[model samples]
Each structure stands twice: as structure tokens, then as C-alpha cells.
Target: MKNEVITIDLGSNSFRVLKYDYLNFKIIDEYHQVTGLADGLIDSGIISFEALNRVVEALCIAKDKLNFNPNNAVCVTTAAMRKAKNSNEALEYIVKNSGAKFKIIDAEEEARLTLLAIKYALKREKIDTQNFTLLDIGGGSTELTISFEDKIYTKSFDFGIVTMTQKALKDGKLFEDLRNQEIVIKEFLATLDFSIKDFPFIATAGTPTTIASIKLGYSYFNYDKNVVNGTILDIEDLENSLKLLKEKSLEELVALVGKGRVEYLEIGTYIYKLFFNVLEKSKSIVLDDGLREGVAIDYALSLK
Candidate 1:
């Protein structure tokens, strides 16, 4: 099937791969693994040897799942690779070892693709995206896009769950770190002239989806996109969840959530809380689809 395509989305916290059939416009197989690529990026300003190896190992596993042939795949990396000083080395190592070519996209391109995914999800949920705002939270950066009549406003922030955890919260000052990041979010949000209250908010990417799953009593192993796609993520609900998450020790947190999530779950959830409060939204629709969907769509179209 020439219409079949594979897309790999490399993130600071995880690596995701999906197989899509352009002919049917359906995703056939999906895989994700947390490699903690961002954990070593903050202080190092480069991709550490260990982090690069972890991602390459994950990519190799992904290749096997896709039958060890991903030549037809569209492999792209996001904020971490785009911002890391040693990104080229890390990507090249993957190419050398795994035979998968990775393209690091800029912030604008990242936001644009995420918006496309939001539109796809909205159509499925029978919602209008013409006047809506989309938030795509990643492990290394956050993207916000607002669409209105004949115009669009978009911005990408440097703060992300894994990045924020390594950069801010590791020093035992969780609230202080959150307050600082919130200031950055608020100032960037204030630049927008659009009436934020006019449009409903939709959030894409892992943080919200994971939060939605936890709120609905599920985990990564038992996650259901259909259940989360149109779920409401409220600020108050997350505030309560934060208190619960904070009480757990590191080991307990990982036991509760997965190892990939425990370290930064609190910060990620808090960021969600900050977004709702700063944007003046009590709750937002959660979308499980993300950049991977957008990548699949684009790769599918390019197959023509």
C-alpha cells in the first residue's frame, strides 16, 4: 500500500511513532516511549551521550515494530532538538545507528502542525475551530494558537514539563518555579489583542491527555483516546489533583503514575492549571491527538 506512511515524533520526554494509511485516512498502529531526552538538556545545553543513546534505542525498537523499514516515514523532532546545541550530533547518531532521518522543525511550523491536528480532532467531535484557541504542550516547549476571522495568532513558549522540572523545580522550590513560569506565560499571553473569552479552549498533547486520563481514572497502559478527546479539564479539578500528587514521594509517585510521568507530572498539571487561569478559562476540551496526527496527514497528502 503506497498510501501507507509512518511518522515518528521525537519529543524531549518521549518518542512516538504512528502508521497511517492515506487511502483510508486511518491510523493503523501507534507506539510511544519515554526516553527522558529533556532531563539532560537544561544544564548541559546539549544532548548528553546517554540521552541520545536512549532515543536511538527507542527508535531502533520503533523500527522493528514497523518491520525494520522506515524509509517511507516522515521523522521529525521538536523543541528539544531545535534548541539543543548538540542536536545535530544526536540526530546524526540516530541516522548512523538506526537509519532514520530526523528533521527538526521550528516553533512556527510546530504550532501550525498542531493547529492542523486540533482542527482534525474538532471535526471528529463536531466542533467549530474557526474562533477557537489551541494549546499544544510538549516536554520541552508549549505552543498556543488562536484562530479568528481572517487572522491567526500563535506563540511557542520555552517552558515544558520535563524542561521546567530540570530547570526550576529540582531545587525543592516547586511553587516558586511555577510562579516564575506563570509570569512568562502571562506576559506572552497579554500580548494578544484578541478577546480570549470569546473562544472556547482546546488543549492537545500529552500533559492534558494524561491529566484527563488520571482524572477519569486511567493510566498510560489503559488510556483511551475516545474517552479523553472531548473530556473537560477544569482548573479546580487539577488543583485538587496537584495536592494529591504532591503528597507522594518520588518512588511512590512513579509507582502511582509511570516512571516517565512521575518526575514532572506535578509541574505539568500545574502548568495546565496556570494556562486555564491565565487564559481566563475554567475548563478546556482535551484532545488526545497531537503533532503526530498532523504529521500523518501531511505525509499522507504528500504521497500523492
Candidate 2:
């Protein structure tokens, strides 16, 4: 019998659970729910009671629906938990209510896992990973990892779509704040010592995949991962899509981007666009595999 395991990613914007056959390295089933654990965290510096409840509820659903042993599960919480003041208490609440124990991983481990996933993805897709920079834009943090001339470099940024959107809203300068973020990104990239010469820029996570889905004419109900996985997204098309998405109401946007993500999509797109401009890349190869898949892959490698 194949050894099966469950991997859970408690993210800032969403909670994701995956059932995997680790021996074969295949995903059996998966569940995702946008609990927005970092909704007000940028200002508060704490995970709210409502956010804890939402996480507990989502975990409970995963437990009941997935029917996997908690002992055999690898659950990890990311940026939100790392920054939250009450992360311990929040974890206690989740375990007590849903019997799901989650480990809070630091930014370094997070980046390592993300890089591992992307590396696996590129290998599976038969893409050249000789020299590339992978960008993972999450809800509470953005991770940039570069594989240049056989050396791997990584850095995690504090700003993410949820946190950035909250900051912009609080400041009452949505577009202005986003524009300022672009400047900040450019300035930060200038400080990096690595010479990014002819590296193929790769993007993973929700923003790029969501934009790719829209470009492929996929809605929430009809999303095709194979089509979105290796899609090359052009900068010009990204900007045009952002403009069109800005006009969509929550109801209309939900059908395209999924629920709980409608509000963050615009700011996410803005940040996504900034990466292209700052990196001076005309297009990016988008991949759907990320931290959740990374954890599963890491676990499988551990058993070897």
C-alpha cells in the first residue's frame, strides 16, 4: 500500500489542505478556504478572535471531509502566525476545536519550501532552471528566490496583498500606496548585489495563477490547472487585465477569482505588475504549485 499523508498550509489569506500519496508524489485531493487570517493583522499585530475561529472552522471541515489522521498530517502556518502576538493561543484553539496541530515556520523555512516546490515544478515541466528568479506573492509576505550561476539566494518581504491592501485602505490612498510600493520594490531590488542577467522570471502563488486563469477564460467553476500552470503572462496583458478587473464588483469578481479573494485581487494585481516592471521582464511563467505542495514534497524526501 502507498503511504498517504495530508499537508495543510495555514496561510495569511487562506487555509489549504492536501491529501497526497507521498510515495508516488501525487496529490489525491485538496481543499481551500479563504479565511483571511491576516485581514486586520497589519494594523493590530495580532490574529483576531474571528480569524482564529475561521481557521478552526476550516480545519474542522478538512478533518471531516478529508478523513486523514492528524498524526500523519503535516500542517504548517506561515507569515500571519509568524507575526501574530497570539499565535500560540490561536494554535491551541485550532487544535482543541479541530484536532489539527500546526507548526509555525519562520521566513527562512518558508522560502526554502517555496523554492523546493518551484524547483520540482520546473523539473517536471522540463523548463530550464539553470538561472531564474522565482517570486511568490503571498497574503502576508512576498518571497523572492534567485538561482543564479549555481548559487541560490532568497529574501522575504513584509508586505503582501492583504497587508498592503489594509495599509492602503487605512491611509485612504489605494492607488497612491500601490504606486509607492512599486518605488519601494525598485529601491530594494537596487540594493541586491546579484546581477540579474537574462534570468527567466518565474511567478508562483495565487495572484499570477488567478490572472492566468482569467486570461485563459477560466472562471471559478471551470479552472484548468494544466492550462494555467505553464502559461506565460505578458506585462501588457497583465496591466490591461488589472484595469478591467478594477471595474468588476465583488459579485462579478467572485465568479472569476473565487470568493474571499475578490477584495484583494486588485491590489494583488498591482503588486504583481510592479514585480514585472521592477525586474524589467516582459513576461513571466506562472506555476500553481507552492508551499502546500512544497511541504508534501519535503516530507516525501524525508522518508527516503
Candidate 3:
């Protein structure tokens, strides 16, 4: 019999739930809803009651979709929830109202699960991962990991698409401040001393992979396993896309990408541009899987 596991990932911009058949090692069902958990966190340093209510509603919907009991589900919150001043309050509210218990994962754990997802995704594609740099860009944070000779070194940055756009890009300071930020990021990356020339870079999260899909001209945003496993984006093409998006207004951006993603797309593009500038010599590989899949993997391992 196949054992079923449910994993809920509460992110800054969206909430996602995955139901995996562990025996088959495959995702059987998935659900996503945008709750914008970070909407007021940047300005207020707390998740507002309105946002909390929205999340609670989403969680209820996710719970309704689950085939198993609430006790059998594994829930986790990342980035935004971790940094919010009212995170504990929010968590308590969810437990009280939604009957869902969630663990707030730290940066180190975030990195570890991300690597697991990367490794799993790579193995699924049968891609060689002897040398690669993995990037996971989230709404409230971005994680970078370097894998060399079976060892992985990871770092987490406070800079994320939501925070970056709210703090920097909307005010037109992103370009001016980008170089200084890049210098800092470059310095941190340099400490790892892993040669970029020897490895291909892998990117996960909504930003890069979505951009890669759009660049490839997918009519709908499906994570084609084929596209994610072996897809590569040219630096020039990515830069061009970012440049085009930068010229558009908020309404224009929304029209081009979709509602609930315009601001993120703007900030995500800026981050990618910085990533492109800093790692000029390396090529990029797209991965559609990340933290949610990582959580699912963790749950699968736990049952063993």
C-alpha cells in the first residue's frame, strides 16, 4: 500500500500544499493560493490581521483537499513568517482556528531542504550534479548553495523579491544600490572559493524558473519536467526580458505576467539581473521544484 503524506508550505507570497504518495515517490495532488503574507511585513514588521485571516482561509481550503486527517499533515512556514514580529501569534491563530500545526524553519534548515529538492529533481532528470551552484529566490529571502565534490555550502540573504521591490525598486533605488549589494553578495560567495568555471548554476523558485518558462514561450505556466531538467537561459535573453519589463507600469506588468505577480516579477527580475552580473561566466539551469518539494521530501524521510 502507498503511504500518503501531506505537506503545506506557507510562503510570503503564496501558500502551497502537496499530497505525495510516498511509496510511489510522486506528487499525487497539489494546491496553491496567493495570500501575500508579506504585504505589510516590510512596512509594519508584523503580519497584519487581514493577512493572517487570508492565510487561515487558505489553510482551511488546503485542509479540505487533504485525504488524510489533520494529524497526518506536515506544515511549515518559511522566510516571511520567520521574520514577522507576530509570527507566534499568527501560528497560534492557525492552530486554534485551522487545527493545523506549522513549524517555522530556520535558514539552515531551509538550505538543507532546498539542496534535497535540487538533488531529487536532478536525479529525476538523470542530470549530472557533480558541480553546480543552486539558487532559490523566495518572496522574503533568497538562498544560494554551492555543491562541489559532494559537499554543499549555503547562504541565505535578507534580500527577496517582495522586500527588494517594496524597499528599493519601487523608489527607483534598486539600480543605484545594486552594485553595492552585488559586491557584498560577491564577497560572501567568494568565501566558498568554488570555481564558477567548473560548474553550471541551477535556479529554483518562482522568479528564475518562471522567467525561463516565459522566455521559452509556454502558453501556460506548467512546470514541464523536461524544461526544468535541462533548460538553459542565455544571459542576454534574460537581461532583455528584464529590460522590457522594467519599462512597463504596474498595470502593464500585471497584464503581461498576471495579477498577483507583477510586483514580484519586477523584483525577481532585478535580483536575476544582479545574479547575472555577478556570475557572468557561468550558465544557468532552471529547476521548477524547491521548498515545497523539499518539505515533501522531508516528510517522506521522516516516515521511514
Query: What are the lDDT figures for the candidates, one per model?
Result: 0.81, 0.86, 0.78
* Model 3 accuracy (lDDT, Cα): 0.78
lDDT (Cα, tens digit) per residue for candidate 2, span 193-288: 877858899999888988899988888778887789889999876886778676877688888889988788878888888788778898899998
lDDT of 2 at 26: 84
Clashing pairs in 2: none
Per-candidate TM-scores read 0.92, 0.94, 0.91
lDDT, candidate 2, equals 0.86
RMSD of model 3, in Å?
2.3
Total backbone collisions, model 3: 0
Q: 1 or 3, which is superior by TM-score?
A: 1
Candidate ranking (lDDT, best to worst)? 2, 1, 3
TM-score of 2: 0.94
Off by over 4 Å in 3: 66-71, 169-171, 219-229, 243-256
Candidate 1 Cα misplacement greater than 4 A, ranges: 169-174, 247-256
What would the per-residue lDDT of candidate 1 be over residues 13-114, giving only the tens digit for each residue? Answer: 978898888777788888888988877787888888888888888887887877647665788899898889888888888788778899999989888777
RMSD (Cα, Å) for all candidates, in order, is 2.0, 1.8, 2.3
Q: What's the ranking of the predictions by TM-score, best on top?
A: 2, 1, 3
Model 1 Cα shift for residue 65 (angstroms): 2.2
lDDT tens digits, residue span 1-304, model 3? 2577888888888788888887777988888777888986878899888888888888777777765555557888889988998899988987887777889999889888888888998888788767787888889988888888878788888878888878773577877766777887888878975576657778887777667767776523454545645588767767766786768777765555656776687678778767866877446888877777888888778778
